[model samples]
Target: MTIQIIVLATNEKADAVIKQGSLAQMPSLQDGWRFDFRKQLKALKHATAYILVREDSPEVIEGCLIFQLVDKMVPYMAFVEVAPHNKGDEKKHDHVAGCLIAYAFKQSLIRGSGRL
Candidate 1:
């Protein structure tokens, strides 16, 4: 399965991600999960969001990440999750979160943060 990682851009796209995230199940997020894309949209001064999706089927999101540029221009991972079908032992995909983190590192480089 070919997956493509992208930066979340619009509220319309964020809505789609919010829908998928609501259906996603991650152990790390089980305690009290909440991905406030609305808040992200409202406050993107130094933040960005990322998502991974099936290349051929854009609607099928595999993972997501939200991060911000903090002091010293560091990329601070704020929120992250993988789709329900792509979590745990019966996962449909692998290393999606890793890919997101790698992407964040790349962004940090692009933004002149040196390294992530």
Candidate 2:
């Protein structure tokens, strides 16, 4: 029941897109989930399953996506986007963020499903 969480690099301000708290809070991401930042270059070496992306936008810190891979394949995932203080633009960004995550997951499944 081990889960690997991977964060992707974004084009925006690196510090803003990659939150230190999120990286630190990896241990709290659901039960049996492990967090590995890019700094830990060797973490991927032992990964049997992968959640290719977990991220939040700069506009809101509450959006997150958790993609799960079971038996070396993505079975399902959860995407959440929250608008802090009901900000309209932030809400839109949250939706886009969720959609982006879902699209990536779908693409990964399409690419990996046949191989497995």
Candidate 3:
């Protein structure tokens, strides 16, 4: 399923998307990502990952979220990170983390017992 949601582009002051992504599309440490997502994904069986990318440039990931349903009952966010360019003073986008976090909540609601 292609779950596409909007984010804010700080530079252009427009919207972007946080879509469902694959393990194959995971970023590497060399890519300036702080975490080793591949290793995390491999270790966590319950993990469900998503990536944030531009609506126009889906090839470039702006952020990511790793959500886990703990014991099939509790909603847990294992990890969440914005891209190197999406952080600090030189950031290109805004609300990257917010979008991912909201998506996590949405997932929790969808997968949970319909109660937050």
Q: Top TM-score: which candidate number?
A: 3
Question: What lDDT is obtained when candidate 2 is compared to the true structure?
Answer: 0.34
Backbone clash pairs for candidate 2 read none
Question: Per-candidate RMSD vs. true structure?
Answer: 9.5, 10.9, 3.2
| lDDT by residue for model 2 (45-115), tens | 32222222223433334333344344555444433333232235322222334443554466466544534
Worst 10 residues of 1 by lDDT: 11-20
Local distance difference test, per candidate?
A: 0.55, 0.34, 0.77
Arrange candidates, best TM-score first. 3, 1, 2
The digit string of per-residue lDDT tens for model 3 on 24-113 reads 888868889998777787788678888988777889988888888777777888989989987886677777787788889898888765
The C-alpha stretches of model 3 lying farther than 4 A from their native spots are: 1-12, 114-116
Give TM-scores for every candidate, taking all chains together and pairing residue i with residue i.
0.58, 0.34, 0.83
Task: Name the lDDT value of residue 55 in candidate 3.
Answer: 70
Candidate with more favorable, higher TM-score: 2 or 3 = 3
Considering lDDT, which of the candidate structures 1 and 3 is the better prediction for this target? 3
